[model samples]
Target: MMALAVDLALALVAAAAALSFWRLLIGPSAPDRILALDTLYINTIALLILLGLRLDSALYFEAALLIAVIGFVGTLALCKYLLRGDIIE
Candidate 1:
């Protein structure tokens, strides 16, 4: 059933989120942490989309889009900082 599939997807996404969080916490280097953070953001977006599908709402999708935009900017800033020692040159 579609409902069962959605439920399974939600669970998998949640597990992925948890793993990313763990990596964020335990990463040995700054770049590793940044990558984990990016992964977390992606997982968060996936979770939001899945939740929207499960709940049949538009709000979660909008929130996911917002998070995606913000996450992208944040990731860029982090990478820039890592490369140049400063976000703004």
Candidate 2:
């Protein structure tokens, strides 16, 4: 059933988010932590989209889109910092 599929998807995404959080907390390197943060935000967007599907509403989709954009920009900034030692010159 669709409901069962949605539940499964939600569980998988939640598990991924949890693992990413663990990495973020205890990663051995800065790049690892940054990668974990990026994964976490991506997982969050996935959750939001799954929720929208489950609830049969388009409302959560907008929030998911916003999160995606913000996450992308944040990742870029972090990468820039890692490369240049500063986010802005």
Candidate 3:
């Protein structure tokens, strides 16, 4: 059924998010942490989309869009800092 599929998707995405969080916390290097953060954001996006599908709400989609924008900016800043030792050049 559609409901069962949605539930399964949610569970899988949630598990992926948890693993990404673990990597973010325990990463041994800055680049590793950054990569983990990126993965976490991606997983967050997936979770948001799944929630939207389950709830049948447009609000969740908007929130997911906003998070995607912020996550992208944050990742760019982190990468810039890593490359240049400063985000503001």
Q: Indicate which candidate wins on TM-score.
A: 1
Q: What TM-score, to 2 decimals, does candidate 1 have?
A: 0.95
Q: Could you estimate the TM-score for every candidate? A: 0.95, 0.93, 0.94
lDDT of 3: 0.91
Q: By descending lDDT, how would the candidates be arranged? A: 2, 1, 3
lDDT of 3 by residue, 1-89 (tens): 88899999999999998999899899989989999998998898898988888988878888888889998999999999989999998
CA shift of 17, model 1, Å: 0.6
Overlapping backbone residue pairs in candidate 1 total 0
Best by lDDT: 2
In the order shown, the candidates' Cα RMSDs to the true structure are 0.8, 1.0, 0.9
In candidate 2, residue 9 scores what lDDT?
99
Report, for every candidate in turn, its global Cα lDDT versus the true structure: 0.93, 0.95, 0.91
Q: Residue-wise lDDT of candidate 1 within 1-89, one digit each (tens)? A: 99999999999999999999999999989999999999999999999988888999989988999999999999999999989999989
Give the range of the ten consecutive residues with the poorest summed lDDT in model 1. Answer: 53-62
Ranking by TM-score: 1, 3, 2
